[model samples]
Target chain A: MDEQTALGLIGDRLAAAGDDCAVVDGQVITTDMLHERTDFPAGTTRYTAGWRAVGASLSDVAAMGATATAAVAVYAAPEFDGTELGAFLDGATAVCDAVGAEYVGGDLDGHDEFTVATTALGETDDPVRRSGAEPGDALCVTGSLGRTAAAIRLFDRGDIEAANELFRFTPRVAAGRALSPYASAMLDSSDGLARSVHQLVGASDCGAALTGPLPIDERVDEVAEDDADRRELGVFFGEDFELVCAIPEAELGPARDVTHCRLHRVGTVTESGVTHDGDPLPDRGYSH
Target chain B: MDEQTALGLIGDRLAAAGDDCAVVDGQVITTDMLHERTDFPAGTTRYTAGWRAVGASLSDVAAMGATATAAVAVYAAPEFDGTELGAFLDGATAVCDAVGAEYVGGDLDGHDEFTVATTALGETDDPVRRSGAEPGDALCVTGSLGRTAAAIRLFDRGDIEAANELFRFTPRVAAGRALSPYASAMLDSSDGLARSVHQLVGASDCGAALTGPLPIDERVDEVAEDDADRRELGVFFGEDFELVCAIPEAELGPARDVTHCRLHRVGTVTESGVTHDGDPLPDRGYSH
Candidate 1:
């Protein structure tokens, strides 16, 4: 069983499992857990771990187009390091400041391995959900994909500096707020564009058909080996914390004009099956 | 370099680190992470783990005298087991329901070992803080203490049934709500009575003096060997989720009258030092 199956036991009362955040009494709440072995690359700094762990969850808050408010973390490590923990808090505080949120406080415990679980809170007048797509809505994404995939490849190849620089993603908080008024359905592509599309389609009961060349990252082309197709890497290798949105055709112009984010018109939501390049989109994407 | 020292680096902007939950804009948020190896004794059930994890944080919420609204969990384990996961959710939902809160969904991931991080959200018109105690305030506790210590002993002796029964602690949600209006300073006795008093004193800039025999568990006496001092176990073993509060002497009767929870006035807040039976109290308790 995967996370989805385990959560299915919670029954239908819960909002579906794949949204950026859970809306509770008008508060947008989201959590992310970063296990050092799985989430932190070999050369990952404690600062980066804190920033990315908290940033990843803040990305969810941005996806909901809510005003970020507060965050708390749960830290578990067998042996505590004062300087490393200080760096981690600094990183967390920096990210929250960048995103207009507060790193309120958190809990700490001792465990065999280092792990950080962060929860972000946000407020919204009209909270967005991932299940509101219409047949003719424009499928849009906030930023370029494939950078994280390329960063991973770089890290694996010992290009630590380049990897760390490329991996630092700026959450589109301002753009999310601007688009919230217009977005019919929206989610963050933290799980890769392909899986995000699948999730959006599944949640909204609508399909998407992409048109023309995909927005492959420029860095992917420069760093990737021949085996790494930029498009495939962009689609399957996830951790792209960009907002994937479905906005009505009429509202797209306003959404574009109001936001400074690089908006990519990827496709259109359909009444039926999902397709990319006029072919059936493969059922593949990042899982964790 | 403990959690306290690490959090101290975050500085004074945050509410002090030792409180059960941090208050932000009238919202009380707290998190607790349970590592399977250290937290779950042998023969412990997944249901109990889930219940205890969420309940632990809820106890924090109760400590703040806030009305809990929601809870989210981050579950990480090497592999997913459907039955165990379901039981966990069952335990979580049961507690939320019992406390009049919603089990808002959560995140799940895979990790090397089993770990569950739970965050509980609450709202309060008059949120209680741990820094409000005044000299001459009565030092009170909700329910009895040393249950968890006794439970651990039972678990060590292979009495799983008694241990499990003892482990199911009821967070004083209703009682907290009632006491919020009267509590001068309040916190949960999660870090043992001794540590809690020390923390309350530290936060409130006051002291405490225990009047008599501690609220030792009757079960501790039943199961303990000759060397087992119930008072020491009660004051030092920790994990008692009872709320420890300081209410003015004039308000103690009203506070007790307003809540159904058993109120025990064990001591009084002093101007300086902490003591038990006219002797200086030891500065010791569970750290995590």
Candidate 2:
């Protein structure tokens, strides 16, 4: 039906030991998904491609509520020399450090172009998965969306604000950990709110309805070339690595309770097919 | 300096933990280096380019005494159908089956080319590393080399042999595990014998002497087009996932006694530097 659904079909055939040092270990979660391997060339500049590369895998571990311990990022390019290769390594090392992980070991090969993928190992007995959400739970977001998307728009144009806020986007680790104890069915909003909503509903086999206003920050509008720009940043664009956790209905005022990332109750999971204000919503939002 | 020595220079700055699950609990040994992210062309063939895309990484895992546990491979290409995409997946899955690993998770994206790079997870409580070899230890090898290099030479010219045993080469897993107890410094003849020999010495800080003749299997004649084929196969080749193990002098022949692989006593570790007899050997071989 969608990427995750399609992946679920395949993930069904594969199984490994419950314990692994990197991906199989309970401490870290692993994926060889489409998004995880693709390198956003834009990430090469502002935050640098290396950190984004390590961050790509670290974010997956973070989403699982695991604190990254070590990581091995494999980088491949056709003919990268000493200086260019050094920048890529530096980029990855910086992200590993900021995220509290270290580079242990990996391989390096020259290929057609740049593709850096990482396998991060983290530690935590408790992992926040994306299937624990209940139908009546209150939907809570851990951070703002549309920023990285905005950065993608302004990247080439040298828009300082978008590059400052978006390209250097950080995962809400503290907020994620804080919400891990109370929230359920946590998934990173990398694809978009629409696609993430599809994941929330599909994984739990439930539906969601968006009622309240979305958290489109003012900074998104500041970087917007037009009204469609802000809307695109808010809905369609991906790479936000923010967490969307389902909390109990009683703990609803997400903005007041959350500190590191702003939270908003944009929707509710339902027993029937999903809808936005009594209208059926799309079955999937993970864009191509 | 050798690759391992160069790696040590970079590995010096890395911070690591001692826990078994430190990187992924119970990891005894890891890979040499991870290639940077590589973008591939769209719709590559299942039995051709796609297989090599995954083989490169899996061979790295085989280089260590450890067995590959899991792999995460990704692809980024423009407008590939689900089936062509499935071929890439099939290639990766075949490697997993061959190596005793599973395809865990990976990423996918639509881009300019069909590039795939995989990170393989392997495990063994006591792995054979390059630093364990000592002077007076016998250098041994499993399987014949240069066929892969020869396969490339013929394949490039469209002189397809009925069966390319070299191109469809499987990593020597059973032999590696069987010899693990005796293997001091172990790795496959990946970059080439010349380079691998130098790698063993540089990392262990000992000299090596290539004394015996190369093990030229009958398969070489089957694939060779001319007499110069021996030279083509021996020097400058890539992708031979055969183990080159070092064992103590007392255990050398006996160690060779226990495998189906073509094990040969190729050389001995020394103190004067890597040499063919008493002459110093060069570290150049397969460039890729």
Candidate 1, residue A230: Cα displacement in angstroms equals 2.1
Q: B32-108 in candidate 1: lDDT tens per residue?
A: 89877878888778888878888999999999999989888987888888888878777887888889988777878
Model 2 lDDT tens row, A1-288: 444544554455444311112346554545332232343534345236666656666776777666777677555555545565566566667777777767664555555556555566666777777777888987766667786666665665666544644555554555656676677777777777777777766667777777756787666787787986676777657677777767768756553465455777788877757676676656444454
Q: Give model 2's docking category.
A: acceptable
Residue range with the least summed lDDT across 10 consecutive positions in model 1 chain B: B9-18
* Model 1 Cα lDDT, one tens digit per residue, A22-97: 8877888888898877778888777777788888889999999898998888777887787787777777878888
Q: Model 2: per-residue lDDT, tens digit, B29-127? A: 232222213222122254444455566666656656667677665655565566666666766678677878766646655555555555666677776
* RMSD after CA superposition, every candidate: 1.8, 4.7
Count of clashing residue pairs in every prediction: 1, 47
Error of 1 at B24 (Å): 1.6
Off by over 4 Å in 2: A1-47, A123-126, A160-165, A250-261, A277-288, B1-9, B15-25, B28-55, B157-165, B225-228, B257-260, B277-280
Per-candidate Cα lDDT values, in order, are: 0.84, 0.62
Q: What is the lDDT of residue B197 in candidate 2?
A: 81
Error (Å) of candidate 2 at residue A205 is 0.9
Model 2 chain B weakest 10-residue run by lDDT? B34-43
